[model samples]
Target chain A: MSQRHAVITGAASGIGAATAKALRRKGYWITALDLNDPGPLADLWHPIDLDARPYRLPEFDLPVDVLVNAAGLPPRPTTEAKVLRVNFLALRRVTEHLLPHMKKGGAIVNVASKAGAKWRENIAQVKRLIGQANDACLDDFVSAEKIDTVRSYDLSKEAVVVWTKKMTAGLVERGLRMNSVSPAAVETPILGDFTRALGERSTRGIELTKRSGTPDEIAGVIAFLASPSSEWVRGCNIEADGGLTAILDTENTIRPD
Target chain B: MSQRHAVITGAASGIGAATAKALRRKGYWITALDLNDPGPLADLWHPIDLDARPYRLPEFDLPVDVLVNAAGLPPRPTTEAKVLRVNFLALRRVTEHLLPHMKKGGAIVNVASKAGAKWRENIAQVKRLIGQANDACLDDFVSAEKIDTVRSYDLSKEAVVVWTKKMTAGLVERGLRMNSVSPAAVETPILGDFTRALGERSTRGIELTKRSGTPDEIAGVIAFLASPSSEWVRGCNIEADGGLTAILDTENTIRPD
Candidate 1:
């Protein structure tokens, strides 16, 4: 059989690189997009900065079997505009741009974060961001909403989770699937930035899970969501956080009446 | 390497039987427990009814690598007490009994249902049921809560989802993992019963998803949760419902402030 094709953003490092490797093991041709080159890991490489305007995606000759949006930025040291623009805006742009090239049974997996678990609590803001036009300036929105760097990162992911759910019915009708995976305190280059930004909150979550998760562990979940094995799984934000979300969720559960 | 051992309840038919097959393909030695013989599908078959009192489970000589609690009953034609006993009480009983026999890296996947997605809204009652002693009378609790057959099934699965989260921290400490899968409108033997009981709710979910999911689709998710690939994934209740839960969640989302 011919090899299937997969398009993955942020394929230069961390979870995106790991997902590229995992899909390669499954006999997929990797089409990688990143600011840095993905080296030989990608069968095809596209170098593009997601923060750049005009949001152009390359055309693919082969029908895409899977699309993984793994590119993102952490809160600390980064501007609120950059965080929201890269994490949410660019991620959605890549997905919408590539949807027409995806196969009928194709799947899309967005790398959201456990920080977005409280999306319901901030639904109004999440929806407002999602409702924004593709061309709208994120800086103005961030200023108007008084979004700090940390809140920008959190709300960006929240938008990813909510937007993933909102797009499910339409995507399923087109014989396609879309889902998201939220990992908590992963041991990546950005881990330091997260710890610096959230301090004890980040450390406490890692403490609860015993340790931070490896990129490969999170990649495994992304691979599963991108595979035919998870055909019936759609628009779900899977928390691959080593029980961190569960611990917090259980602790906050309402008491019996 | 020798084949790993797996213990699956409700292995006679439906998702249970399909999970047995999926795990078998992954080279796990299947120990099936059910009211009927699993025939060639099981490496060892223990004929037992989940509704029977005393809740006995056979002792495993081999260390179990996986335990899948797939045993469940639908609402129609079944009493409220029977549904709760078979779905929640017996499931928890079997898990506790077999946890001692499981390997250090063992995993447990419980078959929950999408009907239980409203667990947060009914957290109080769900916790009340989960807090009951192992030998507590489910019939008395059902009567006190005024739970009908449908609510009984829903609440039972809700207990499974919530209990799965509640157990994560302790299980992770022991080098074990536990998770659940919620499938919407699966084409199992009990599908007719669900359609009859839920009426429009069941059919509407199927309609939104385009078609009812096959048992194999749900089993595929259970198998992934049981595998080592999902090592960092603990206590997550995966919605393998083809976006049914997403549709409902999106529809109920709060408007922008």
Candidate 2:
């Protein structure tokens, strides 16, 4: 019998690769998907260019038991369009295409970010403007507005969290589980890009938490969500940021003036 | 001297109506924007359908000192498209559109919901997929997929939180402020829709929290975000949620039955 199958996006490197390796250790037969031919894991890795491609299941077909949408673009102003296309739209395509193949009791783990936490304050408006725009309108809006940089990255992830929350009920009834993981300042190659996109001050603040996470540290959480152990955990966004999100008490103050 | 100009969306009834009243009482000029005309606020009410028409500034254009995005669709499945359009897209339009009209120290408060807190778990994936879809894609995807009502509501709110975070850097540098207010179960007609959408079990859970908030209660938080006292607070999703989010912990604890 085939070992339980797992599919990971952006599986060539970083957290995606780590998650694939972790799942392999957990006895899953893996199919790693990415733009590069992730050699050595050739039997598992399926090269994919998300921007130019639609996720056709035949491209990397397996009886997918667990899916980790780890494919994404990091923060960068120059790569804004690529970021939206790859990170947001492409992620949705992969999920929508693969969701049909999900086995009973299968799990889908999506990676978001702590940057998206504040969306609650403005979601009511998002809900109102859900589907009224065409591609032309979107393009027109973007061009008219001249929006560039990592804000798109932040916005795309905001939609991901929304989409995940939107899909949990169907997944539940189908015996499939869906959840998200938001990590802060993981020590990855993406660090350089993130620092460049958002200034040194902000990056330093994230790093000051004294807890730049390892790939495995994040993989562990993804693994937990992808595992049956977290079956009841639906529509949850687990903050693996080591308490960076907790509000500081300004009252117990020491001023550096 | 111009009375402080305020733009309130979703002013047809409920929280939007209540907020318009509250802001008017504070001696601010009000310009209510909604599809349905909420007759007789103090200054003016501009009724327009955001989804069906393009927004145009009024003839008596005063500088918008405070803009409150409160227009939204109630929590219902068929209404998901409408919800997302008004709640997310329109809010973005208003904020971006009015930025030019806003004074240096202006405030923008978008009314979000408590359901958005789950972003930490799936932060990576969420950051990937926002604002990249065209209308056709969104419609096709939303229709083909079965969404969880509660999760959908929460997800839309999560997008707002993310947007708020993205706006913070710009707002601070420009001497403006942007924040979100999330109420728990509010005593609005939407509560019935929310209860019906979430079904009986979760509705009971909300009631157990012991404080179904009033519109004025949430409006108070919005007013605070609009005021100078909240200057230091930018990109914060203030939870007027009556601690319902706290229950996320108790429910997560595994108990031996």
Candidate 3:
């Protein structure tokens, strides 16, 4: 049989890049999409921009067996609107556009953040925002709801978490599975954003893990979700947050930001 | 000082009523709101229609020391719209309206469900939805998102969990605290909802604690969050789900829907 194809976003850097290389070494053909070129780690490269939604994937003759959405913007000086546009709208647009090309037994794994853990508290709004197919309507809904841009980053990841579960029941019948990975404070360029917002105590003071995770650490879990090992897993998010969430649950400490 | 005021919602039955009784016994002057009369447990009772938003909570002479939002609908055959209106919108409307009556060192504990544990995944969307206040716009927002009514129950609770955390920072600036209690399968009138939707295996198969929790058990946690004991907790959610979530966390099982 021909090698399986895995389409990965954010393939240029961080978890996305790490996942692209890992999947490649694991014998899966990688169709990498990102704003940056991944050098030679990827077999087929799509230099795509995530800001533009309704993202149409290039034609693929081989069956796309896995989809790994890893592209995202961390909390920074950018507007929250842009954060939602890239992390959520773009991810959805690409997934829906690519779904028909995927076959039975295929899977989708979106990389979410621990920061968006409160998503359960906001499922109604999540369903509301995810219903919009493109940028204009989604932003319109966001504006009407009056969500400030400051929260766009965490909120976008939260949307992906809900979308992952919401799409599960329907996707399973079509012979597809979906899941998300909520990583806690991975050591990436984005770690600085968190440190600034949360102070040095953010990473140092609390946490049983005691250190941030590496990109490859996150990629390992991403690969597992995209594989058949997680067949019975169904619509669940793997909290590969280094037991920080578990510690929080045990300590009954701040229910996590 | 005058007996501190504690405002409790869903005081008609289940966790809400249990929390009211627990708070009252702990020396709080209970100002209870519910669709049904509290009979005699309440010092002052307000008959509330949760389906109605922007509810005019009756005037009170004393300051509110704690606000416990325990109102909700279980997963059943109901329009997702109605579920969102009641669980999320009404909860928000009442919480915001009553904020003025609460002083520094006050606390808000929203009774959420383990079913909404996926809330961590939907934080961004949750924030967006929570930013909105009324029914029509919220409905329009939900309709735009195209969420099915079938998952409304879990979604609403998820909203509550996120709202609890999201409001913490702002509320604390005004000298208030906010948190949520996510209970697991409880032996309430609605325990049947779990048995029906998830089968008997839902409760029996999983959990370190074999039996479902009681309303008073959840109320105990609610009272703690509302008290000075949880003063340093900050913006977070307290999971009182009898180790079910902890088990899921360890086993990496399907996230509770």
Candidate 4:
């Protein structure tokens, strides 16, 4: 049997890099995609900008049996235009490029965040965007509105989680699987970027979890989604935030801004 | 007190129409948006081609206090390009457009479908998209990708839900609320279109609820989000599906396709 191939985006750092290393350790051929050069991983296939590039099968050049989309940022208050373009808009671009090569038993692992819990109430607005989902000028729409960059990110993530479920319905019949993982504050080297994005006051004390999760810890969950052991898992977003989501629930306290 | 202003998309039919009537009944001046003519709600402002038009603030010469994005299609297997565009691309455009005019105690409600429950396992892809939320050309990024129309609806809704939560961190400080609603087979007049979009097999028994819910039923939940009663309900998506999602968990024994 040909070795199962896994595609990892954002592979240059944090969870993406860790996920690539872990999958490689498991004897899987790894195709790592990132804006930054993927440093010394054995048998690595790196790609230029995923958003900008034409999605060749196995986006990194090898045939991919599994795809892990692990690139993203946290939300901050800023330009609405920028946020929508990046988080949700760019994500849709990446998914389109990768779909044709996904086979039965093939799985897609989408890295969502714990913030995705609010998916049930805003039906009206979500539907509208879904209606516009067809238009090719998504950026023109945002640009015309002059939206702040920060707000667009949050909206983009919301769209990504929603699309994961939608994709599941489409992929189910094809014997392909699609699911998402939402991690709460993994202590990725990118944690600093997250910190900068979220003003100090907002991120303060929220780090009550004595230890942030390692990139490897987050990757373990991704591997599970990609493997046959998780075949039955469909459209479920596993939360791997060191029980912080549960803790926030226990307190019934909201994440303070 | 000045009456709150609301911008609603897809207001000519189904949930959009119902939500428009519901909001009007609640005494808010409605800026109803849709491709179709607004019929009798002529007194209410209607924007043609919400997806194509630039989202100018002071819509109808009034600052929008709330935004209800209730437009989209059912899930189906389609070209990957179409799926991403419909599902994620446009959603970012509308949300980013309206964020500036939204004020303290303001709320943005997005409408998603029950199909988006699969985000837990796809964390990486979600992150990559989420990362773009802050970029200057996020929506343009989507336009450049050339996604399809049908599948994009579901994916966009998923992104919408995720983005709502991400925005909470920032919006909370501004006293603005962002939330989503996911319905399971509501009895909207648009059921036929949804069924067509969802394709034949899955549509067989979709209306398994105590008869499908009316747009009014779903609208009540949306009104709640817009009211002071739900001020603390930030970043929440209430499932108004008459427990269909929960019941599906028990009734359907998922089989790997």
Candidate 5:
């Protein structure tokens, strides 16, 4: 088989770095993108900060087979506007820019959060946010909507999930597939930020699941999504969160007879 | 790493056989069970008919690390009672019987159908069906409920999905994880039977997706679910149906502003 090329954002560390290793093990040529250099783990490196406006991606000569949007800012220690922009808008900007360069049979996997699972309940807000222009003033939007830093993080992820679904038909028509993975309380560098942002909610999820998920575990799901094994799977947000979503879903829906 | 053991039902053909191959590639000792012989695929084989009133599984000295309940019956050329029995009841029976032998940190993956996606809508009927005793008269129940062959097939799978969710807490408490995979149309031997039963519904799904899924595609999902890579995922029903569920979900929920 010929070698496949994968472009992964946030490839400097955590789930993105883990995915880089996993796909490298599968013999994929990795093009790592992040604010910091991903070192020797990347076959090629591109330093791009997601928070920068006019998000410009370098033109690629090679056809990309896989694109993983794993870059994001957590709630704590980040402004609400920055969280929304880095997490949602920048992801959209990168994907749109890379679409033409991606091969027909290529796949895209977005790293969403289990906190975005409540997208259904907040559909109106999510859709409104998704409707905003990429370069729109997110600060004004956040202030007007009264979205806090924590809520901004959740809303950004929720938008990611919804946008994935919205983009599915168009991508599938072009013979490309797209999906997302939602992990709960992963033991990444951003874990402390999430703990500070979510407080008891984050701790309770880890308590229920016994431990935080390893980045390798989330990457395993992403690797599967990028491969032909998941050829028939598209526009889905896979919950890799150790039964936390399951417990919440079942408890919320199931009633005693 | 020592070779782990996996017990898979319906191992004579389709997704079950494919799962056996996938797991074997990962150095798992496969114990295959089916009415027909699985031949060379099985390290050990047990012949058992799920349609039999008293479902009996052979004893094993090995501590099972994974269980894949891939046994099922389609809507066509099968009685309602047999369809329900083989698909849902037999699955529960085998899992309960084998729970003692299954190792802690082990996983169980149930094969369900996309037809069962409306499980939430039919939760009342699903819960009632699950409430039935193991030895209850399924034929009488079908007649009383006025369920036809197709409805039986859907109901059986719905029951499987709900049962997976219902069993999650208890199983997790025991250090065991359980989940289900729902595939759309797949090009298996039973594809004809499903086509005959579902008619235009099945063909429309195939048309929308451009083609049917391969058994290997579904098996890849089952393999991931059975591995430590999916340690955090439990009680979730993964839809591996080529964006069919996603289209339905997005179209159903998203409203015109």
Candidate 6:
């Protein structure tokens, strides 16, 4: 059999970069798309801007074996529009445009944040946030919903998580699969943003299992989802955040008599 | 104290109607909103079109102690956009408009379906669907995401469940609370939708715990969320689906080696 091709966004640094390396080791050729050049592991590199306005996805060869959407904006002093666009709208655009190109038995893996763990909480506003394509529309959304950049990041990740579920049937129709890996407080360049948004004491959750996860650790989960091993794990969001959400779930459980 | 006012949406039938009657017995003056005339269970009634474009909200007397959003479109022969608009978008519009009217110690209850049981699976798309307003936009969403009407209803309820989680901080800041009840295969006007969507063989999960929940039984959960009895249950989504979800969760559990 011929070597399969894979596309990974946000492949410059962090999880995307690590996933590219991991997949390369699995004998899959990588077509990397990121804001910065994803070093030598990429069999083919597309050094495109992640925050490109109006969001036009670059063309690629058909029957791509795997698509990993690890591109995203972290919570920091940034505009909510950019956060939503890069993290969600762009992700959706890429997936929708590329759906026709995915081969049977292919898999798609998305990266979401644990900040989005409670996405089930305020879904209406988050949905509106996801639809906002430009600054004008996003401004209206942010003002109406009172969402800050940090919340925007959470909403974007939440949207990514939900989008995976939404795209399940279409993928299943074609005998393909899709899933997401939700990571929180991992050791990445964006770690400071999480520390700032959630505070250092919030590390107590991560510390529960000892320490924060390395990019390679999260990459392991992404690679698993992208592999034939997790073929039955369709439409699932695997929590790869070092048991932080599990701790929160434990706190949330208070059984009634 | 003066009688506390409560607003109930979709109060003409099903869980909304049951909740309206249940709340009236709790000494709250019911302000019922529905597409149909609520048959005398409400102290005040507003018969408005549920499909009003741009979602114009009705004026309400302030200091509402409880708000129950039980209005929804079940999976029938309907457009995906209409289902999403009625079940998710319109519900959001009402809740956002009424947030300020809620006084301290207030509580909000949203009726979500068990079809949304897998909300944790795809949160991102659920948020976007919840944000879609009209069919033109919802059509773009449905086509872009490739979501069907049944999936739309599931996404809508998933959004409701998650929306309840998202509003926790804002509600807490305002000294108010919000929660949702996810009813599964309940014997209601909409139960046929579940049967059609999931089929007859699916009830084995529901039947494991005996019969499906009655509207009154679900109303009991909604009433609990609305009253001071559940003050500590902030941002919680109560699975009032008579243990079907529990069975599914047990089936999903992968015990550690």
RMSD of each: 1.6, 20.3, 17.0, 20.6, 1.9, 19.4
- Each candidate's chain B TM-score? 0.96, 0.88, 0.89, 0.79, 0.97, 0.92
Q: Return the lDDT, model 6, position B167.
A: 61
Q: A1-257 in candidate 1: lDDT tens per residue?
A: 66889999999999999999999999999999999999988999999899888657788888999999999999965489888888998899889999999999999999999989889899989988887775357778888999987899899999999989989989998999999999999988889999999889999999999999999999999999998899999999999999998888888883322
Model 6: per-residue lDDT, tens digit, B1-257? 98978899999898898888888888889998988889789988888766667555788766789999988877765567788878877888888889888889888888876677677667667656655655457777878998875687788788887766666655656787777767766677877767777676446745654566678877876776686634544565555544454345334431110
Q: List runs of model 3 lying over 4 Å from the truth.
A: A53-56, A137-143, A198-201, A204-208, A253-257, B1-257
On DockQ, the candidate that comes out on top is 1
Q: Chain A structural similarity (TM-score) per candidate?
A: 0.96, 0.86, 0.90, 0.82, 0.97, 0.92
lDDT, residue B195, model 6:
74
In order, the Cα lDDT scores of the candidates are: 0.90, 0.66, 0.73, 0.62, 0.89, 0.73
lDDT of 1 by residue, B1-257 (tens): 77899999998899999999998988889999999998888999988988877656787899999999999999955498888878888889899999999899999999999988889999989988887775358778878899997899899899999999999999999999999999989888889999999999998898888899999999999989999899999999999999988888887783323
TM-scores of the candidates in the order shown: 0.97, 0.49, 0.51, 0.48, 0.95, 0.52
Per-residue CA lDDT of model 5 for A89-130, tens digit only, reads 889988998999999889999999998998989999998898
True contacts kept of 1: 0.85
A best-first ranking of the candidates according to their TM-score comes to: 1, 5, 6, 3, 2, 4
Model 2 misplacement above 4 A = A1-257, B53-60, B133-137, B143-148, B250-257
| lDDT (10s digit) by residue, model 4, range A1-257 | 88988877778888888888888888888777677877775367555563443434333455568988887755545445444544565566666777776666788888877655454444334434444653356566666645344335545555666667665555666667677777666677767656666555226425543346667777877876687645544665556654444345324432221
Runs of candidate 1 with Cα error greater than 4 angstroms are A134-136, A254-257, B134-136, B254-257
lDDT tens string, model 2, A64-126?
Answer: 789899888887766655665676667777887888788887888988876666555535432
Tens-digit per-residue lDDT, A1-257, candidate 3 = 67889999898888898899889988999988888898887888888887765446677777899999999987665456677888898888889888999989898889988767777576666656666665866556667877764456667888887777666656756888777878877777777877776565366523445457788878876776676644444456656554455455433532433
lDDT (Cα, tens digit) per residue for candidate 6, span A120-148: 56556655655565544665676677778
Error of 4 at A257 (Å): 26
Docking class of 1: medium
DockQ for the candidates, in order? 0.72, 0.02, 0.02, 0.02, 0.64, 0.02
**How do the residues B1-257 of candidate 4 rate in per-residue lDDT, one tens digit apiece?**
99878888777888878878878887888777676877765346555553343434334467778888886645445434334433454556677777777776788888876655454443334445555543335455446644344434555665666666666656656667677777766676657656676664236435433345667777776776676544434565556554454345324422211
Worst 10-residue lDDT window for candidate 5 chain A reads A248-257
Q: Highest lDDT: which candidate?
A: 1
